[model samples]
Target: MELNSAKPGLLCSLEASQSQRTMYPYVTGTSVVALKYKDGILMAADMGGSYGSTLRYKSVERMKPIGKHCLIGASGEISDFQEVLRYLDELTLNDKMCDDGNSLGPKEIHSYLTRVMYNRRNKFDPLWNSLVLGGVKNGQTYLGMVTMIGVNFEDNHIATGFGNHLARPILRDEWREDLSFEDGVKLLEKCMRVLLYRDRSAVNKLQIANITEEGVTISQPYSLRTFWGFSAFINPTPGAQ
Candidate 1:
């Protein structure tokens, strides 16, 4: 009894769990938008991180390339997203070390992440992020989402967080399987512009990532051009007074 009490295995475990669990996200992002195009998958997200109602950081890059086949965008806690990336880093490193010439693909990465998120939820300590993963493999374009609690699904177009509320409707109205690269970009911009207008947490500065048969290309950070000349913008309730 003394030795077992000295180890304090259960106590140590409880402490570790408490340390890692996030009851709520502190620094968070707003939305992620992605879709399929003629050549590949395109993903976009802004660079802002909000703490409660305050915009705390303005240069957080929430999209990253996974292995050689996936582009991942995340919305929600920035630190949790970074930890998830570290998990992928270890996973990819191990895959390469195998030296079997078989690398992990987009589907595999997505599945692994789904399991990770689910497991974390089962532990009652979720990652507090919504993830959008997109890729092109063997001429097949893939786009999917996994929420913070691990609900996952595939779709022709995907938007997370505020994008799900404000941007997906636009995607549903206009997305197509045969969209050209230029058209796809224009479509994403349209969605993002709406999020910027409606989602107070969203910022104009953002990055776009493209993953294709050739490889992944993440654009340098840039801002979208917006117009505020609409009547509603000039005065929201013109006659309320």
Candidate 2:
């Protein structure tokens, strides 16, 4: 028997096949916390990215520095957040080139990001993230949150994703506009501890960053337990309450 080959134009690929190959899954990040202190802003996020009941990551650093004085902490797709960081880095470098070698400041960075997020939202394909932008704007500490769809608002304290449910209440209760920098730090530390206990996505060892007029300072693997005077494993006496 002779075999015959099908003509190229006579056959078409299945639509379902194309769709299946092109479709990508969406991933959500767990929590991000941001608060404004007297001198600057403090932000932290959980290391975990959960899909359903599964833990995806445990050491992800969701916070990023946009320029010299501004910091951005995000909760959502890690890949998308990384792209935003890359774009911001390029934008900052370009701005510096036009400013006689002076790096872009917090306000300038925030304005640039507002336009970036809005532009993406107009295209109907946003970055799939919520962001906290903070630093000193106009000689005073400033803090704002931007949603995935580009809505931006300033707040004394803001928490997104899982942190919104687990950490925001604690933050709001303790937040004071007249709080000193030290008090602000202590409050944030307490907030992180609460999240670690209540928010499954949050971990005890986490990254913390402070943005101020002086610039951005990031602490690596800051120990929440050390600050709280407790170890990860608690030893209980037989009759302990």
Best by lDDT: 1
Worst ten in a row by lDDT for model 1: 1-10
Model 2 bad stretches (over 4 Å): 1-27, 101-103, 226-241
**Clash tally, candidates in order:** 0, 0
lDDT (Cα, tens digit) per residue for candidate 2, span 58-130:
7778887776678888887777788789898788778777978576666666677777888887876677778
**Pairing residues by index, what is the TM-score of model 1?**
0.90
Write model 1 residue lDDT over 89-178, tens digit each, in one string: 999999999999788888888999999999999999899999988888888888888998899999999999878888989999999989
Tell me which residue pairs clash in candidate 2: none
lDDT of each: 0.90, 0.74
Task: Name the candidate that leads on TM-score.
Answer: 1
Error of 2 at 182 (Å): 2.9
Task: Tell me the deviation in Å of residue 200 in model 2.
Answer: 2.9
